[model samples]
Target: MYLFLNGEILHKEEAKISPFDHGFLYGMGLFETMRTYSGHPFLLNDHLERLQLGLDTFNIDLDLQKLDISGMIASLSEKNGLQDSYIRLNISAGEGEIGLRTTPYNHPNILLLQKELPPLMPLREKEAVLLKLRRNTPETSVRLKSHHYFNNIAAKREAGDDPGKEGLFLTKEGYIAEGVTSNIFWISDGKLYTPSLETGVLNGITREYIMELAGTLGIPSEAGMYMPESLLKSDEAFFTNSVQEIIPIHTFEGRTFPGKRGRIAQQLYSHYERDAQVLFSKNELHRS
Candidate 1:
C-alpha cells in the first residue's frame, strides 16, 4: 500500500507523525473514509465539504484548496495499483504543547491512505443488540468524525467481533440513536424513517443521499427521534454508510423484520450505483 504524507508518497512503515501532535495527544483530529468508484473517488466534494466544516468548527487552519486532492488520489492509486480503492483521509492539529487548552494555531498534519476495495459481499440482514452504553452529547455540540472515539470504541468492545451482529446505541435520554458506525433507518407501511440529527445522529453522507433519493422517488420519508419499539415493529429496516451503502437488518434483538430487502432499500441502492457512474465520469474523476 502507498500513503500520501504531506507532499510525498511513502510506504506504511515510512509514514510518521509527532507523538505530541494534538490529534495524537488529545484526540483533536478529523478523518473521512471515502470510496473510489472505478478509478475515482465517489462523492469527493461532499466529503471534503463536511471536512471543511469540521476544520472551521475546530479552528484548524488547513486549506484544502491549495492542495490538489484529485491529483494526489490519482497518484496514490497509480502507485498502489488499486484503481478501485478505499481511502482514509486524516487531518490533525500538528505538534503542540501537552495540555487540554485549545490550540487552534498549530499547523495541521495531513495523511492520505489508499487500499484496494474488496468485492462486496451479499447484503444480508444483520442482527443488532441494543447495548447499555449510551452515546454522549457531541463534544463539539455536533458529531464531526473527530478522534475522540472512546464511546464508540467501548460500544464496539461490548459488541465484540460477531459476523452476524452489530451494536446499536441509544441517547442518554434513551431514544433511538444509531448503529456503532452506521446510520439506522426503518420502513413502515411504505414510509421511510430515521432518527433525526437532533437525536445525536452522525449525519452520514449516504444517509442524506438516501433521503434525497426517497424524495425523488416519491417515497414518504421522515426524520425524527423514534422509540426503539418503532424499529421492532418496522416491516423493514436497514443501516447506511459510505462504503457499504445499505445493509438490511433481519432482527433487532428478538424482534424479527421481514428482511426482504424492501423496495425502498433496493431502489435506493440501484440508483446509487447508477448515479455513481453518471455523477463521476472519466473526465471529472481523472482531472489531474
Candidate 2:
C-alpha cells in the first residue's frame, strides 16, 4: 500500500511524522473521509470546504488551493492499483513545543491515505441499539472532525464487535444524537427527521447533502431535538456518512422496518447514485 505525505507518494511503511507535532502530542488535527467514483471524488469540493473550516478552527494554516487534490488522489490510486477506494485526507499541526500554545500553526503536515473498496452498494441494513454511553459535548462550540475520537471509540466498545449492529447515541440529556459512526435519520408519516446540531452532533457533509436531496425530492425534512420514543413513531430509519452513504435500518428497539425495501430509502439512494454517475460522466467528457 502507498499513501501521499507532504506532496510525495511513499509506501505506507516508509511514511513518517514528527513525534512532537501538536497533532500527535495534543490531537490537533482534522481529517476528511470521502470516496471516489470512476476516478472522480464524490463531493470533493464539499469535503474540502468543510476541511478548510476545520483548519481555520484549529489555527492550522494551510492553503488548499495550492494543492492539486484531484491529481494526487488519481496518482495515489494508480500507484496502489485501486479504483472506487476510500480516501482519508488529513492535515495536522506540525511540530510544536511540549505545551499548548494559542499561536497559529505555520507548518502543517498533510497526508492522504487510500484503501480499496467494492463498488458502491445501497440499502445495506443494520440493527441499531441505543448505547449506554451518551454522546460527549464537543470541545468547541461547533463540532469539527478532529483527532479527538476516544468518545466514539468507547461507544463502539459498548456497542461490541457485531458488524451487523450499530449503536445509537443520545445527548447527555437523552435526546437522539447520532449513530456511533454515522448520523441518524427516520421517517414518520412521510416526513424525514434527524437530530439537530444543537444536540452536539458533527454537521456531517453527507448529513447536509441528505437534507438537500430530501428537499430536492420534495420530502419534508426536519432536524431538532427529539426523544428515543421518536423512533417508535417512525416507520423507516437510516444512517448517513460519506463512506457508507445511506444505510437503511431494518430494526430498531424491536420494531421492524422495511429496511432496503423502504420506499423513501430506495428513492433517496437511487438519486444519490445517479448524482455520482452524473459527475463521473462529466469528468469523462472533460477528459475527452
lDDT of 1 by residue, 119-198 (tens): 34346677878999998778766789889888889999998888677799999888899888889999999999999989
Sliding window of 10 residues with minimal summed lDDT for model 2: 279-288
What range of 10 consecutive residues in model 1 has the weakest lDDT sum? 279-288
lDDT of 1 at 17: 94
- lDDT (0 to 1) per candidate: 0.81, 0.89
Prediction 2 global C-alpha lDDT: 0.89
RMSD of 2: 3.1
Clashing pairs in 2: none
Residue pairs with colliding backbones in model 1 are: none
Stretches > 4 Å off in candidate 2: 278-288
lDDT tens per residue, model 2, 51-156: 9999989998888978899899999989998888999999999999899889999999999999987778756999998999999999989999999999999999
TM-score of each: 0.92, 0.95
